[model samples]
Target chain A: MKFMSNKTLKMSKVLLSAVLSVGIIASLSGCGSNESAKNSATPPADSAGSNLIVSQTNPIVIDKEAKTVKVYTEVNGKYFVEPTRHGVVFKDGSNGSKSVLKAWGNQNDFYNGLVDIGAKPGNNLKLDSVGVAVEGDPLDVSITWAGAGKEIPFGDGILDSTKKGFDFRFGGNQENAKAKNTGCILCLDSCPVGITSNAAHPTKDFDNKIAEFKGNQEVLPADGTPVVVTFKLK
Target chain B: MNTKQRKWLNVLGSGLLGFNFGFVAALLLAQWTWLELRVNTGLAILVGVGIGLGIGLLRTIKRPLAVESISLLAMLISLLGIGDAQISSLKILTGYTIREGLLMPDISLQVANLIFSLLTLGSILSAIVLKRKISG
Candidate 1:
């Protein structure tokens, strides 16, 4: 390195910095400010008499005819909160880093959407500081992804996560709750609309830090791809 | 070159190098998920110090204080850049609301960014303090 003059070193450093800056700027360009609030989402004008229950501001549609609740979502990436685990999280929630799908809708609205389709709200799981499922009844619900030609159960897209699909419970309304967002739309751990475990069998309890549950990369699309998630009663 | 000219050159060069190195590290921390999630805080700090040491070892130094001062300034700028990039990356991936995301970041991301920025400063400081042995 001493053989090279100071001028050469400066030039090289400049080139390297420029290269890195461009790459990061490109990635940054892909992202836009979150304006979901400013532009309220409205349902299609054609569906006046149809059995479609749509949110005025959120991207949730309750289909009473199909006996299902549909939510708009995008792939968060194969590696979210954990190495292998890929859970579903609310778009407005803080746990997007740990979830595979980012659902763009209100959690409360999702809950009501389920109710509209005759799905009963089950007891929500409560966890200790260590994140163990101490209490809560599992709701009778089934989650699926039909973005592909055929309908695929949520368990199929996941790898080594669970045996009994996804055991979910309606984590009741949190209208006045002081948490980041009221009502849990869908989570891996204990919440009103969360699943039993993000991991299949943890050494101790259901912790989000564990990298046990992985998304099957072959089955799922790449990150940032938009898709629909459906919820139905068992 | 005169002594004064040499000193100024050394200071400016070190500061620029430090800023670029820190920016590169931030980009890596933002893009790579494994590094961000798996690497612990202590290890991250060590890595930062190591980068600083490497920068110091590369240069021929006479006046260390001037270089150190500039390096510190560079560290601050790098810290801001890293924080903004990390937040923007999270917002894009998660679609978080402006209130909860840009303004109020997740505790986990905050911890991660803090560690990364610390590493940037460590590298800059180490580089300035590290002396290249004069080869006869």
Candidate 2:
């Protein structure tokens, strides 16, 4: 390194600083203005006022080329939830699914809980935030959280990504498929019927229709698309 | 460079590499998804890559693969900072950040921008510290 001239070091400093400063400024500056009240500080929590169920969709497709998952979900409230497609979409690059899930808690347990409890990851999942609500019986969602915010049905550990994620699968008639490695604590142990496990097993719980379709392809009755889905909440 | 010096240098260099690509991916997520990211995705990525290339230059000048551990560690650290940076600013901008991804699909719009912005910063900081030895 001594062979390198001092001029070279100085140039490196200037260049590194220039690039670093610019990158930092771009990201921090582009947030528009936090001071503006226009910021939707609070995400719409309940869908009662809309007289419809709010739906949030996660569309996940396996990208065999990348040996990784390329996932996209509807950020704004949406509808027509599809079960086969949802689950954490694993993006190959930044906004990587791993850390992002930490903001919520643990994607595995949370996602698994949702699926096992009838919440599908693909475009078939719905919450009361906005969009179309399921017209059937009301959804019984057990919720939890790691930080402060509006309480979500079956929402907990929404901000934690350090732990192992939970597994989402269907219950084949042969045996209940247990998607292991749950990241969230078991919030609910008892239900009206004995169909639920003290450990919040989605496969054992009969309440979750999404969990019933694990490992097997099922045809969707609503869209006639031969897809699987869960009941969306409004 | 000596074995010890080379090892540390690589640590700093590797982070820049991971951070560069990570920054780019983060920006796209912000743009495509309505989720507001903290930093400008485009600029952040450029910065990350520039710093990474700079680190790479330093490595090749002295040694190659000497900083392998550092690179992997830095990459992981870079990912961690992304969330940190976003949450810090988000708490200030909105009363809350992402507790649940209710707004957008996977992440909340509120915290999305903030998280990636912080990630860019983390990479920049890593680059600066790592390059200091080489530059000086």
Candidate 3:
């Protein structure tokens, strides 16, 4: 009886150890995956019976007549851990802690979609300290949630908790110092796309130092809830 | 060194192991369900801590300190690994944008790796020291 119990205890401990080892190894092996591969494989969700040009591999619908572009997105990030600072952006472009919605669509596609609707892109944003000039098209962004059953304006879904806010402008992403554009679409910080209200908002790769914006949990749906984001030329 | 101290150590380690596992499980579950199940950060944390504390207070196992610490460490590493994998997969599928002329670096992964590294080191050192003390 004593030998049986000891053997069982030893076996259980070994099993626990194995579980721990395998779980960690599996997690670490996930680091090398590339999103670009998956992006090319999956087709965009269909938008039939609508006057919208939805692409084959991208998650956007462009309406030339309506002069608007819509991108499928989801409620992302949170108010507690990382304040929601971005209105809308490519999933990889914005910091997870600060972004509100990580869009499924490509940033370059969204920019082109806006252009298809006749929104001219121009260089109006000037970051004096960084000596970087930014080009942006004024955009009227809004969210339509399936859960809420209503369209919420940009200001309604996102809030400047400090009460200091600005209008969002589509700052089409710029090429890096290496002359490669990574398709960064829109940002709260004054990047290629930025808040027109804060001309002084510094450009950053991920972490935005001026993080005053956050999602209005009461108005916004739960995280990961599917939604449509509309961008109209202002 | 005494029986009471050893007993409490086992409880603490068990509780920590439970909390770590619970927290990681909650994160994975939230991702798997896409949060439609309403698994938020608060709920995950609350459930984890509650379960951990419960196991700590209620469990009667009197494991050696070295065994307890090593087990806790192993669980932490595994949980951290799974968290890393989930974050990476999410990034690969959804987060593939460029910033400053390059792919956006995995900041969360880097931070998580650093935290787990420190924890693993601490666990190793404690296990060795505790084993030596018990033997001596």
lDDT of each structure?
0.44, 0.31, 0.48
User: Residue by residue across B43-114, what tens digits does model 2's lDDT show?
Assistant: 444455556666554654242222322333343344334434453332322211221221233433334546
DockQ-based ranking, best first? 2, 1, 3
lDDT of 1 by residue, B1-136 (tens): 5645544445444544444444434433543544432332123323443464465456546534334444444433443453454644342322221112223333223233343334334434433333221111
- State how far residue B56 of model 3 sits from its true place (Å): 21
Off by over 4 Å in 2: A1-11, A31-234, B1-9, B22-117, B134-136
Q: What's the DockQ of model 1?
A: 0.07
**Native contacts recovered, in order, as a fraction for each?**
0.00, 0.10, 0.00
Over A80-196, each residue of candidate 3 has an lDDT whose tens digit, in order, gives 123433566565443332356666776666766876888766545443324343446667776775435555676677666445455566554333311333334455555644322
Per-residue CA lDDT of model 1 for A149-226, tens digit only, reads 544666666665444345554444344222445223655544433432322232233334443455555676544455
Model 1 alpha-carbon miss at residue B11, Å: 11
Ranking by lDDT: 3, 1, 2
Task: For candidate 2, give the lDDT of residue A13.
Answer: 55
DockQ of 2: 0.10
Q: Return the lDDT, model 2, position A176.
A: 14
lDDT of 1 at B65: 34
